[model samples]
Target: MRFVSFRSGADEARLGVLEESRIHVLHPGSTLLGLLGDDGERLHEAGAAALRDPYDVLDLDETRLLPAVPAPPTVRDFMTFERHVEGTAKLAGPDGRVPAEWYEFPTFYFTNPYAVIGPHDDVPVPPGCTLFDLELEVAAVIGREGRDVRAEDAAGHIAGFCLLNDWSARDLQLTEMQIRLGPAKGKDTSLSLGGVFVTADELAPHRSGTAYDLEMTATINGEVLGTDKWSSMHFSYEEMVAHASRGTVVRPGDVLGSGTSGGGCLAELWGREGFDAHAPLGPGDVVTIAVEGLDSMTSRIVAYSDRGR
Candidate 1:
């Protein structure tokens, strides 16, 4: 089943299941965060009954779709793609090489949850940022609470999946990370979600052992960024969930980003194809991404209000 959070006119945020171009609205004022788990499997019934029989149906074009899990409890982005890591190393300079530690476990960084926005919303180009970028990736929304979960059992804790766009200020990120560590302001600018949450059973047919055989693509103003397979990830979503739960707790509404695909971001391309080959994102540039059944997401880059003369 596919679900989304939406709103029309002055009505409050509500849950809805997507069927083609129409949305089957669930209970009024029901947010996605409240229905993120299944019966016994986790908790919350996962809104199965309501999803099976919605309160009303409406044309999707008439209402505004919101982030699948608006205001997630917490968001953690993990580096699970080997090729992306290798490419990032190349961008570091001539002595670049993949770190051995990356092979041992999935590495991740916490990002801001308050900064997340809907798919159709505008992405602001942070003030003073010249190297604006977007990451085409997938994120797993945790369905239930778990601490120190095993990789083999992590799948049960995941409710569903959605596309994630980790918009970035590359120049700021690179400079700061070089001195201190991980990104903060560089990535807190904005984040985009697919807005449609796809249940695990719906995608089970496409499962390929450790990964899903889903084909993902991204485009910048109609130019393709190269299609990649979701199955190529060196670390699976379950593994990332397990690693994230090693010491702390991962609760429902928490999001787990699968990191950027090999060529999902401008940085990866600049690293693999040479820095001069492609340019950074700017105002008016539209970015879009799609992953099989997860529905597509598009965002237009808008200039910061304080910038320019």
Candidate 2:
């Protein structure tokens, strides 16, 4: 089932199951987080019930979509794709390859959950960032709480998956990384997710062991920029979860991003080509990212206009 968090009939947020061009409201006060309270089975059942009962149906055009798990408990983004890592390293200098330690375990960074936006939202270009870029990735939403989870048992902890666009300020990020402890201001600005939340059970047919055999693609202003398969990730979501849960607890609604795929961002493309050959995102550029079996998310880029800033 495809779930969507949306505002309807007076801007009240609600959970709904999307079908065709209509959404069936599952509950009046239920939210995405509330729905994921316990491994998401109840939410799945509610969605199934709504589909059968055809209750409180609303047209998709009349509802404003929100992030699948608006205000997630925590957001951990992992660098699981070797192609992305290798491509990014090449930009630093010659003979750059995946770091040796990177092979030892899944590495991730915590990002600001407050900065999340939904599909079709306008992402303001952060002030002073001329090298804005979009990262195409997939994120797994945790369904159960666990500490020190094992890789073999991590699969059951995933509630669902959604398309994620990790908006970036390349200029700021590059500078921060050089100084050794940042990626902060550069990433804190905005992150876009969800046009739809697809439950793990719904995607079982596409599963390839620990990974999904789904196509991931990104386009800007109708031009294809990145395209890859979800199967390309070197580390699986299970590995990421196990690693993240090493000495901490992971709860439901916590999001784990698969990081950027190969050629998934301008920085990688620039490394593969040249900075002069590509342009940064500016006002009015539309970025669309899609994963097979999941709804696509489209965000429009706008210039920052806070006169006070």
TM-scores, each model vs. reference: 0.94, 0.96
Q: Per-candidate RMSD vs. true structure?
A: 2.4, 1.9
Q: In candidate 1, what are the lDDT values of residues 1-309, reduced to their tens digit? A: 788888887888878778888887877767667765543242234456655676888899988988988889899999888878888788877568889998999989999999898988888898679989989899999987899999999888888889999999998998889877879889987889878998777788899966799888989998998678898999888899899999999998899999998788888888877768788999889999989766799988888872222
Candidate 1 — worst ten consecutive residues by lDDT sum? 38-47
Residue-wise C-alpha lDDT for candidate 2, range 138-163, written one tens digit per residue: 99999889999999999889999888
In lDDT terms, how accurate is model 2?
0.87
Candidate 1 off by > 4 Å = 37-48, 306-309
> What's the lDDT for candidate 1?
0.84
Lowest summed lDDT across 10 adjacent residues in model 2 is found at 300-309
Could you tell me the TM-score of candidate 1?
0.94
Model 2, runs deviating above 4 Å: 306-309
With a 3 Å backbone cut-off (N, CA, C), the pairs that clash in candidate 1 are: 37-46
